[model samples]
Target: MPRNSDLTPDKALAVKWINDNVAQLSRDHMTIWNLHEPSWREYKSSAWYVERLRAEGFDVEAGSGEMPTAFAAVWSNGDGPTIGGYAEYDAVPGASQDPVPRRQPRVGVNRHAAGHTDPHSALGMGSFTGFLAAKHVMERHGIKGRLKFFGEPAEKMCGSKPVHAAKGYYNDLDAAISFHPHSFPRLANSCFWDTHSAPYWSRIYTFECDNPETWQNAGAVTGVAHGHSAARAPGAIDAVCLMYTSSKYMKESMLPHHGSWSLNEFILHAGQAAADNIAPGLAQIQYSLRAPTLDMCARVFEVLDRNAEHCAAMTHSKVTANWITRTRAGLANHAMAEVTWRNFEAIGAPQWDEKARSFAREIQASLDIPPMEDPFTPEIQHLTAPWDGEKAFREQLPSWQTNLAADDYVDYTWHAPTVRLYVGRPTLRAPNPGYRYPEWTRHAMGGVPACIDPMWLTAGKVIATTILDLLSDGVSLDKAKSEFRERTGGGIGGTSWIAPLLPADFAPPVHYRWPEYVTTVRGQEWTIPTAAP
Candidate 1:
């Protein structure tokens, strides 16, 4: 058993490394627009990390699957068991912010806010901690085996799905470990199901009306005028209105609560070099649709196409429609979740009270927060049940029959065994006196070298220790796995489970394109775009 003292040196080193490197990491992660674009510089940053690992005597590989920043590093002591540690360093495009907040004089100028309050700078540091801990253990105890670190990019908006599919990254590892920062401290045993709210597809359509007389009459009669009306007298603008009204009916009729659908980006008279005399083109409009299943999504698209064709026929204008992009089916992987929960508990993280856990139940039950569903006095307490893997799996299996009496579609109960945990600085306020602050978070960020540095060191220690426990020979991986499963109420094959509300036969779409680029900025990926102009 490793004590807190066992991780002190590694943690100290990690905190130092992160504090020194955060600015560079933040810059790399926040600059990219798309992960698939070659312009993103995260690829280079990942390579830099790899070189650092090499200096530490680890074997490193880069450019996994054309994704520039995606890489793997390994330290092996003969051929024994293998353990993996993963880290994510992607940024949310719209969430860029400065390290600290600015006051009044700077308020109106879009001062840095909302970027990486969760500070993923800690991930790399944490991973480093794991790496060094393993190094120390191997050196001191003569433990022989392989410890691998994965620099995983683009997790905002669930980028991991594609990474998982493209690289088969997690498929062969004996076990994997990672962590994230959060407001509260508790292990997350339930992972969100990757179920798309509805299959929603989007299309952009442009219409041009060439009839001069009709164009002028329609615009004048409707009491609508364009700024550039004098240069182009084409009836294009009128045609756009006609299309808008036509699509509005279609939208209202198909609307389903939390179902599928949406329409936006209505651009009118957008073409340049078109003055008065009824411009040659009326307008361009973009419409989005969401549905519960692929079939329904397809049906919505067909309706959109038919609506466009009808608009074309009525306006006697050319109409061109094209699909923009389609997201994959939402995910709900019970098997992977089962494995995740087991690993979480085996790590000895604290658990939450069943009564308090009901907050999640409420969210699941409503499928949304309330004020949205206040009219019905549904059983709110039912939402708080702990996730039961066996129950969820049996219910999701193809052989299971739908039970109409139960609210299959309600999503009112815990559905999976996905866990999330937070380790904070010791300086943070404690809920009460009896509870000792974990010292974990506080010490990692505020100590002499700073608490963040040490936290990373501790992370490495935890990863190495956990991996050793899991992969050691005669260690009863199954028993350890079972113990974790039992904490979550059982494996997915058990009987007392409620089926997920998702449609049967749904499969998540697989993206085969390798990431064209990797951003290296600190924080969530979406924050990057917002951070800039």
Candidate 2:
């Protein structure tokens, strides 16, 4: 029998370190909240993380995976088993608000600028605390392991992680831990085991009718070709419209309504020069599809391709589709998930005190709902299993489905044995046991210190302790890896496992007309861009 060192002491130290540094983590979380950058434009937010990681003595790669906003930081202590901790710092575009109980957007910020809705500000900082805390204790105890921290941007777009996966960033990990703010009532204080996320592939299809002359000439209405002005082709605008309506009409039939799959379409660019209207030449439509399997995504894309082609041919235009992101469905390691959950149980769920409750009352009063002495129920503060809460709600979601929502973090599951952890975020108590809270109410609560800090701190403690578990105990790591190989068809490229969906040389959609801030005579600000007057 092999003699093993006690992990109980290391776990204790990691928890203490996280608790001791909660104030610092809170400050960092506030900084990221104020930055509030959206998608590929997270320059300030990304830079701040890089600076902080460098300060902590990790060998920093400023722009890993060819994404400007993404980074990888590595710290090794004589190297036993390598573990990965991931962070997502991107903000959602539509909503921007301050931390006040009332709804108020940030001042001196663009009216259309992004805000932390999933509140990735806390997500990143919370993970940051875990990464640093684990590293701190590992060094003190002479532990042997390598810790890798990755800064993943554009999580809202379901972007970044797939590219990193394709470029082989996660190829060498023994195990990984991923955390997100839990919005679902059922998954609080829980970690995912078997069913994981569905596959997500977002593509942009561009339709170009650069020359109506050809369309007119080809038609030749009277055997005498009509002039460009008189015989105008419907052009890109009609092509886009046809595709949109056609897809909406075909939505139900794309796949059997039996499974949980969704298709969302956005008009990215529609006619560059609408005023001129000499057959408005260019249009772009982005279709983001999510399904439980990649084969399902491919099947849906085939129909979409046919729709774009038919629409383009009808309008005498041509269409081209580009993959904005392609993430495979999640893989699971029961051992790894159990290990993470055990650490979470040791740490306990976030403890919300009177201050957080007081703030919840303020929000309730603002909503004109009578405030309760304790606004949040036990679900918000107590830890529960994935199967513990709201059976009726769980029943509505099909059991065969592992992932109801599409998130790019699922990409990591294929690379290494990973556990997806979810802890509770702030939610309104609601006027009644079943009343729904306003969107802005929950969004505002996410930014409030009292409402969100417990989550950040608790998540930090759990993540750090879990990392230490695998690092110190070879039995824990081997069990995780063994289960991973069994599930992933012998790891990465096993019989059933496939390579990353995107090709290695595939280009990042950096040039796409993503939303961002523009500098003008009034200095710098962010908003959805507008056409020139």
Q: Which candidate is the best by TM-score?
A: 2
> What lDDT does the true structure give each of the candidates?
0.42, 0.82
Per-residue CA lDDT of model 2 for 451-510, tens digit only, reads: 899888888888888888888766788999998888877888898786898989877787
TM-score of 1: 0.47
Q: Evaluate residue 23 in candidate 1 and report its C-alpha lDDT on the 0 to 100 scale.
A: 55
lDDT of 1 by residue, 324-442 (tens): 33433332333333333433333333222332233223323333323222221122111211244224533543342222111011121122222222333212322335645322232
Worst 10 residues of 1 by lDDT: 404-413
RMSD of 1: 12.8
The count of residue-pair clashes in candidate 1 stands at: 82
lDDT score, candidate 1, position 21: 58
What is residue 60's positional error in candidate 2, in angstroms?
A: 1.3
TM-score of each: 0.47, 0.93
Q: What does candidate 2 score on TM?
A: 0.93
